[model samples]
Target: MLFKFRRHWETPWEVVDSKAVKPVYMYYDDEDSLDIVAVSDADTRGTYVFEVNHLTRTALRNAVTFSRQQLIHQVAKKGFNVLVLESWRLTIFRRGKSHRVEVMYSGRPAEALGKLPHLPPPPFMDVLHEFM
Candidate 1:
């Protein structure tokens, strides 16, 4: 087996949530974002860490999704209920015989002033729900 191979960046593409509103809201850039400030307590450059032996082919499409969700959970622990002007980078590589996916996201963390609104899921989300 080759010790080194060219790395690819595609696995991270499948695990993305484009929803505009949620408990931990996400925005790609300042052009369309909320009025919030960046909090320093949260981990901005969160890395995806996992064991290769536990990797499964079916889970590949959801790896980045998991990473981002984990980051949000951690930030919430720090009192951040929302994130704005967010961006993420994805990486795909091989560990031994398995292909692994990772995601690192950066965003301005903020606490919503009042009760965060929780609207019904977008109509388009029904397509996703059906697959579950």
Candidate 2:
């Protein structure tokens, strides 16, 4: 099989919990994947890490086909009792007895809408120290 890949930006993101909220910065390696760097104003539940196998064609498409409304229901069908997903390619794995529910997302609004509005920065801010 043949494959093609492109790199996204190394940008800061926001993570909002029920009572507390903070910012998280994500960086990309030349390896075609991103890594979590820091969370502002609050500590992470732990150093949560995710290495997306963008090559997983089937899995990636299956994840994206759900309607905006069905996204939550599809995730619940897996196992998570309570779930939260970010706007971008960040997913949260919630605990379950035999397994956990995984929410997979990627912020490709431009790809989805063909054109998007010029949105402002997140409420919180952080910097991306370029990997040297």
Cα lDDT tens digits, model 2, 1-132, are 297544465332323111112323222234232222322331112212333343233432333333222433443344321122223232323222221113333221111112323333321212111100
- Model 2 residue runs over 4 Å out of place are 1-55, 67-69, 72-86, 90-101, 104-132
lDDT of 1 by residue, 90-131 (tens): 455564465545656555566655455542221222323322
Number of clashes in every candidate structure? 0, 1
lDDT at residue 116 of model 2 (Cα atoms): 23
**What does candidate 1 score on TM?**
0.49
TM-score of each: 0.49, 0.18
**Pairs that clash in candidate 1:** none
Candidate 2 has a TM-score of 0.18
Q: How many backbone clashes does candidate 2 have?
A: 1
Error of model 2, residue 84, in angstroms: 19
Query: Which segments of model 1 are wrong by more than 4 Å?
Result: 1-43, 50-61, 115-132
**lDDT minimum window of 10 residues, candidate 1:** 119-128
- How far is 98's C-alpha from truth in model 1 (Å)? 1.2
Name the candidate that leads on lDDT: 1
